[model samples]
Target chain A: MLSVHSVLPSLKANATSNNMTNKINHPELCQWLKSIAIDRDKQAFTQVFRFFAPKIQRIAQSKINSEALAAEVVQDTMSNVWRKAHLFDDSKGAATTWVYTIMRNVTFDLLRKMKANKEDNLSDDIWPLAELANTEEEVFTDHIQSRNLQGIIATLPENQQQVVKGFYFMEMSQEQLAVHLDLPLGTIKSRLRLALGKLKLKLGDPHD
Target chain B: MIKHHPKFELLQGFVDGDLPASLAAGIAIHNNMCASCQQKVSQLTEQVAEASFEQSFHHKIIVNDEENLTEIAEMDFDDMINQITASDDVEPTKAIYDERSIDFKGMQYTLPSALRNIELSKTAQIGKLSRARLNLGEGEIHTSLLHIGPGGSIPEHTHKGFELTLLLAGTFADAHGQYVAGDFIMLDKRDQHQPATEHGCLCYTVANDALHFTQGINKLLNPIGAFIY
Candidate 1:
């Protein structure tokens, strides 16, 4: 069995300096989200806030033209990140893409509320959380990137290992398995169940 | 099989979150059915998301560093983090089991999940064409759920503004060719087509101006003008 360190050799190299002009580490960010969701780690949330708060503010400011509204966007978006972190599946896409989706939806709903009297909150319905993962189909072409699955499964936290085995190796219904890899549904529910309800197994190697 | 799809520009607009609610909903409906478009939207989203963060971080390094940290970002990051992390309330995650359907001309058709929540006006019929307007309050733009009965045809017409017809079910044909369910037909002032169906079809439409009929004495009178646009 390959150690997690052996599998992800670049994990350490992907760390960000204080300025963060260097390419923000996508896997590292995913690890942070996983930590926030499973451990409710405040330090992880702070790191996320430091990275995203400014970007969201500038993006919101450019779209809406109001400082107060931009602040609200940051608050609401980050709040959602904290609450919905468990729903994020790193296999679907980068952490930046997932967070950006949240920010955009918040901006759209806010714009609608400002203009119209009735608020249907159309963004969530339009981009349903489950389907958002399918858009990153390139990554799900045929499950794990042409690798030794047994080697990598050993690297995951125990709970996540069960999920990978049940989803990929077990006999699951076609309805449960969606998309090319049969993910985003049965596996998503499993991930949620593992993270939120039953086992508190740390999903990723705890964020540094 | 679906033939028509939203153009590159429209899809880009959608991923960028720049389109109006009516238009955004249309694209979403299409994406639900079109696997290729769904992949495109996701890829586009990744590209946009990457640029959004990269540009912002790079900008911070240049000039907005101190001024943004001090003046622009008036909200305290630490305070916000503290408040957010205080709540252990996780969003309950469940797969949607929506059973939303709309009936037209005595036929019941399942509504797209995207339109499951938005309100639709009472069905209004003009001969074989039935339209129920979407309740979105976008000014100057009107969105509707339009049903065309079997043997129904929209009179040949031209438009002064934009019109989008996303076929949700059944088959339709214009002067160009045949369109099946999941087809996204977006037209501007320059385009003209008279769509008809041998088998009834349901469509989600968005338009800004009344169409100008091109044939018969009704041309000047604009007989079908108020009905569609």
Candidate 2:
């Protein structure tokens, strides 16, 4: 089992050169999540909430323009964590990644609902696709790969990193990013492709 | 087996949660049946999560914990949980697909999970080419299930906007290429083709705008196609 105690040394070693505002590591957060899952520990839940809620809220606010909708996204995301805590498997991924997945899905769900309402013709059932059946082993492998990615992404060139941040986190399209950065569209696309290529190399061939 | 899949850029948009619902749904349906695409999506989702974490940490957004805690404390967790769980119970599509299978031309074919709740409306039919529309809801793009029987052909037509067709069963071929089960075919305004099936085929099609029939004989279908599609 990957435990907080086991990963602390490595996390600290990696933190030395980085200017991180918060020092919470994946293992510590995962431990707290396990407590909530295994024991319904409110204290653990509270800790998880205090650490993740604001970060998620910020992400939601960035992607979604509406304050009310952003708040709703955070609420729904946390409640999902609270209710579905038992479904979490630490071996599958870091607690943050799992939580982020839930938040991302919830945000998209809300956006789809908003669009559906505006259209007034789409059935709500048509939007969210059926969840894929992910086996435990597959989840574990993805978790390891995902954890490794943080360090790899950190190692990317400064220019590639900036492009990746805008593309991935801000969810900007190539055209929008080109316009925002005042760069040619081809340059934006090439930068994104280069960044993705490096990440793909570090992560290994996804097909394998 | 499937050959062509959605481009990596489109799938990237999917994992980033940035694509429109219609396109996302289309990709989701393709991912459901294509393990290769599913694996790609999984990798992209992980990449997205990692990027999000790094970005969140770099910005020092979590430093204002006290204000957020108060915000959390003031909110009703119970009510929020209830609302989420209530939506969870509203699994209409799940139940429908579990309980029902589609019957077409005396043959039973399973509906893809993404398409389970869509209600197919019968449209025009000529010879072996029969079309039925599925209203994906208001403001959302329109989709349809096109059934071309053996030796059937759809009149040569050019797309007005983007059209994505996923072959669900059997095989079909247009000027571009032959398609089998799980094949995702994307056609745009510049492309025109006559699609025909030697062994009949079932396909899920999504169109941003109505198809523009181009052949002289099928030019007559322009008005009818506009009205039905």
Candidate 3:
């Protein structure tokens, strides 16, 4: 099993910084998360909030136009982090990736609420059941696979990478992406398909 | 054994969190029954999360709002912490149960985890066909749990908008094809069919509008189909 320290050496180097450090590094943030999970450490949580709140706010703002809504997403996401901290297994995935999943789910939930006339409850629907960690070995394997996926994505051609980023991260619809890039819809569709195919080949079977 | 599954595009949309709530619910229920699709969704989720993290690493930092930060800092953190910590005792709507099996007419039918806490509004029976509508409360989509008794059949009907059905148990056959447990069937306005079951079946169905009954005696039931659905 790979340790967090081994996976992220740069982040580990910053972990020894003084407790007064305002700009908490990734490893320290992850340690703080562990503290919250294990001991409900309020001080550690405070550091996490100070580091991630603004970053999450920016992510929400980019997807949602309303400042008020963006702030709400950030608050809600952080609140969930505090509440469900025990569920966060660092062996399964990086803290940033887990937080990113939460923010994306919240943004989508808010959008659905705005679009629908009926009040839909989506608390449990945010995370897929398959993603939940049931055992330590499973968590470790998933962490390694996710890390490999990041490397494969980074190695994709620039054009494919741009389309993948715009579609997945920016939440741009295919039509919106075609219009933004001044390309035909077919081109955008094919690029996304090809990019995903290459990633699948590199990552091997999903079950493995 | 389920043969048909949701297309890759739909599953991809689900992973990206771009699918509508109704469609997502359908896929969730399907994932509960199908291990293959579950693996696929899990893979897609990891890929999306990894990519999003990389993008965040390079994203430009936004200027902080000191006033807003101060307000958040001063809020009742203790109270908020208490509520979250105490949430375990007070169950949320989505309660995890050891077993989510429904008893109907002396038979136990196990349901997918997604359908565990949903309330069934009403049950209507006509001859061999019986159905219970699952109230998803005020959405454009209508979802229901339909049960067909032995040698029963539904009236020939056409969909008004989009209709997706995930068979939970037993076997059902339409003019299109036969569907078994874990089969995901999707139909739109362009398609029409009459469905029947020899062994009886249970299905989780979602539609944009009530089914349109198109043939003979069933056509007379069309006006009331909206009510039944």
Candidate 4:
């Protein structure tokens, strides 16, 4: 068993002093979190929170317009992190994915409550991909796979490709797409559904 | 012909971490049983990972934080684990009710102070056969564990987001059928059904979002259904 002092050698170094933008998973940091999380280590939690709080803030701000609301969402999400630390099983899901899922849920809840009756607008920046930890090894693997997917998507018809981008990258609702193109709601849904099905086929997704 | 699940696209959204909570929870419940959907989810997950790895669009979210709250949290996680692993025969909390004891079919369900006036009490559960309550998003979601005795039932209902029920003891049957101890049942907005305990049951349910009662006729009778979620 590593002593707290021995494991926390870089604790002070990792603390936010000058607003340093560090990678999500600094090896020493992840190790410290794993130790604290399993053992309910407080020092480790503080270090991890200070580092990730900004990222949470960023997600909330970029997605939701209100800074105060975004801050509240971050605080709520952080409190959840504290409470559910024991539930984290590394084998099932990554820490990054788990946190993003929480943020996504919170954001969705807020948006849903605020805009219960209003139609969703697609032109706005609605769909932003959640962040994941990236390592050097993952980068190499991704380069090859992305090149393949990019090539496949390029082969799709212009209309299908546009809808895919509009839905996936832009996060437009089917209604929004319909309104944007002056098409029937059914047409937009069918088009996006068919386009995705074909893309999955070309990508050789198992379901296809 | 196996009609492709409507959730194929929804699962894709979930894998990509883009779907709304209600939709994602619905898809998750379905995915728990469908291997085909799981495969598609895995594929989408791979694509997402690849897209993220090449050049992550934004900063990553870290779920675990071992900081200021650690002092109170340093208490053994094993306590929870033990509670989870312990047999139902060994009762940890009280079944006896003094003033707080709820009498339903001769079984006592002790109400915690936080939930004393909440009206989700044992009697209320039994009296109303088919009812639903929208919790109005109150209380600490997972802390209070609810126990439903044998033959006890909660009327047909749907959730706004996600509902996780880990059966600690006994059995319960819903529209989807029966579930026993050690069986973790998840439900979402898309699902609507009643759950009834058989041979007595103890369950820990964690609900995110609200509960919607589909039996519209019952809603008119129980105006204060504000509590039964």
True-structure RMSD, every candidate: 14.7, 7.2, 7.7, 15.8
Q: After superposition, how far is residue A199 of candidate 2 from its true place, in Å?
A: 9.6
* Candidate 3: pairs in clash: none
Candidate 1 per-residue lDDT over residues A1-208, each given as its tens digit:
2122232232324333543333667877999999998998888888888989987887787578788999899999999999999999998888888998999899989988998755888998877765676643343353332233354445566645544433322212233323323356666566634533222122111110
Task: Name the better of 3 and 4 by TM-score.
Answer: 3
Ranking according to lDDT, highest score first = 1, 3, 2, 4
Regions of candidate 1 where Cα sits further than 4 Å from its true position: A1-21, A135-208, B55-57, B60-71, B95-97, B220-223
lDDT of 1 at B172: 91
DockQ of each: 0.18, 0.21, 0.17, 0.05
The DockQ score of candidate 3 comes to 0.17
For all candidates in order, the CA lDDT equals 0.73, 0.64, 0.65, 0.48
iRMSD computed for candidate 3: 8.1
lDDT of 2 by residue, B94-158 (tens): 33336445656666777776666556666566667667777656453677777778888778888
The per-residue C-alpha lDDT of model 2 at residue A113 equals: 65
Q: Which candidate tops lDDT?
A: 1
Give the per-residue lDDT of model 2 (tens digit) for A66-107.
Answer: 667778887877877776777667766567667766786788
lDDT tens per residue, model 3, B1-96: 667777766887887667776677788878766666666566566655554444223221111122232233233444544544444321132435
Q: Return the top candidate by TM-score.
A: 1
Better of 3 and 4 by DockQ: 3
User: Judged by lDDT against the true structure, how good is candidate 1?
Assistant: 0.73
State the DockQ, from 0 to 1, for candidate 4: 0.05
Best by DockQ: 2
